[model samples]
Target: MTARHAGYIVTLAEDIREDDADHIMTALRMVSGVISVQPVTANLDMAIARQQVHGEVRGKVLQLLKELQ
Candidate 1:
């Protein structure tokens, strides 16, 4: 199958602390094809991670979120 590269966004759950969000962002950056990780200030508990993935990357992003918990 051909590799399809696209942006994947990881959205954190609300009520997460700032420190925890920061830590999550750090871990997200370690994922493959991750271009950037930015915190969403509008929601303290929420953050968005931008990544370029080949094929499907939602699973990976979900795993990352699970790891944060």
Candidate 2:
């Protein structure tokens, strides 16, 4: 016999406004099998920082490639 445990973390494609976060969390709590719902704004900030760093790195690589050509 085996027991299974699983969890999921979801990220939205677009940023949710502060005013709407509570509403969103409330809706998620209403869903079945939802043990808990907590908002983590830090992850969103980290994601944005990561994207900015990625863009900077991409631009630098492209510039380097042009210089090498």
Candidate 3:
């Protein structure tokens, strides 16, 4: 018998600089138990960088919650 757990996906509203993202990831990883922050695609038209922040945090989305709050 085995058990599997579902993960979370967080999307940041603002286009975050790579350095800032790295800092946030470090802070959250300590408690949030994150798996990884995936590719960030910059949209020239919208001037927004979309990134995939995946993990198993029980509460709010890490990237967006951190940046928004």
Pairs with backbone N, CA or C atoms under 3 Å apart (clashes), candidate 1: none
lDDT of 3 by residue, 13-37 (tens): 6678776677777765775656665
- Candidate 1 accuracy as TM-score: 0.45
Return the lDDT, model 2, position 45: 78
lDDT of each: 0.68, 0.83, 0.60
Clashing pairs in 3: none
Count clashing residue pairs per candidate: 0, 0, 0
**Could you arrange the candidates by lDDT from highest to lowest?**
2, 1, 3
- Tens digits of lDDT, candidate 2, 1-69: 897657668777667887878888888888888989877675777888879989999999999999999
State in Å the error of residue 4, model 1.
Answer: 3.0
Error of 1 at 15 (Å): 3.3
Best by TM-score: 2
Looking at model 1, residue 68 earns an lDDT score of 100
* lDDT value for model 3: 0.60
Tens-digit per-residue lDDT, 1-69, candidate 1: 999978776655445777768778888899998979877565323223233332248778788999999
**lDDT (0-100) at residue 67 of candidate 3?**
82
